[model samples]
Target: MMQLKWEKEGYIVSDDKTLLQMGKIEAWISGAYWAAGRSREIIEKSIQHSLCFGMYDKDGRQIGFARVITDQAVFSWIMDVIIDQEFRGKGLGKKLVECIISHPDIVHTKMGLATKDAHGLYRQFDFEMDECMRRPLL
Candidate 1:
């Protein structure tokens, strides 16, 4: 698959795996409310398989991350979006989402995500809450 990238004011959003900081990403998601206790192996495997976006500051440090599990034609589930604590209020998260949803490979696919408190942010991009049913296997 072709990698996608976007840049603004020295910050870059890209699907390039070489730009991903695995340690930082594992640290963030492993401590996140949704995936607390997740293992490094699991995180690594997920990143290896998913379409991922990494946001880097001008200094080339990874500051934000998002991933989409998709077939590139029909369905996508956005997951693990996070911005570094110091970078939270600068709209980097929004840029990350935009880069994911607007990518040509999956832009027209049906996209979905679950968030406890980011409804307002997703709403700005026209995402609506929908009733969903789940069956836990564990």
Candidate 2:
């Protein structure tokens, strides 16, 4: 997949996986409710197989992150969306999701995501709860 980027208000969101800081991402995501106890190996594999977004500040510090599992044709499911706690309430999350959903390869695909609390945020992007069944193995 072609790497893509979006910039706004001095913050940048990029899909270049090489630009990701694994250590920081692992730390932030490991503390998240959905991904707590997730190991680096799994995270690394996820990034390798999925389309990942990393949001950075003017100085290039990563401030937010998200990834999408997609076929680039019919379906896209977003996961592990998170912003550094220090940067929340600044609209960075909105920008990050904007970049993801607006991405060229994903724009036309049906998108889905699971969020424990950020419903207001995703709803802004037209994401809504729908009837879908899942089988959990965890």
Candidate 3:
């Protein structure tokens, strides 16, 4: 996979696995309402298969994350977007979403994401609610 990176001021956003802080990611997702009790192995596996973005502070400590499962042609599902508690309210979330939507590989694909909150934030990037409901696989 090609690596994608963006930097602004003192922060960095990267899709380089080398820069990811797996421990931090696991800790955050373990407490997330959508992923509570999720195991490290599962997190690792998910990262391995998905296009992951990691946000780092000036000091290079990881503070945020998001991932997309995509075919690089038609479909993409953005998932697991989170910013560390201390980093919230600083617009990093919007930056992260912007990077995902503007990414060369993802921009033209049909993107989908589910959020219990943050609908307003995503709307700023043109994300709208889908009329179709998800069907479970047996």
Model 2's lDDT to the true fold?
0.92
> Measured by C-alpha RMSD in angstroms, how accurate is candidate 1?
0.9
Q: Local distance difference test, per candidate?
A: 0.92, 0.92, 0.92
Model 1: per-residue lDDT, tens digit, 45-128? 999999999999999999999999999888999999999999998888888898998998899999999999899889989999
If both were scored by TM-score, which would come out higher, candidate 1 or candidate 3? Answer: 1
lDDT (Cα, tens digit) per residue for candidate 3, span 77-101: 9999999999999999999998888
Clashes of each: 0, 0, 0
Query: Which run of 10 residues does model 2 get worst, by summed lDDT?
Result: 1-10
Stretches off by above 4 angstroms in model 3 are: 135-138
TM-score of 2: 0.96
Ranked by lDDT, the better of candidates 1 and 2 is 1
Better of 2 and 3 by TM-score: 2
Candidate 1 TM-score versus the reference? 0.97
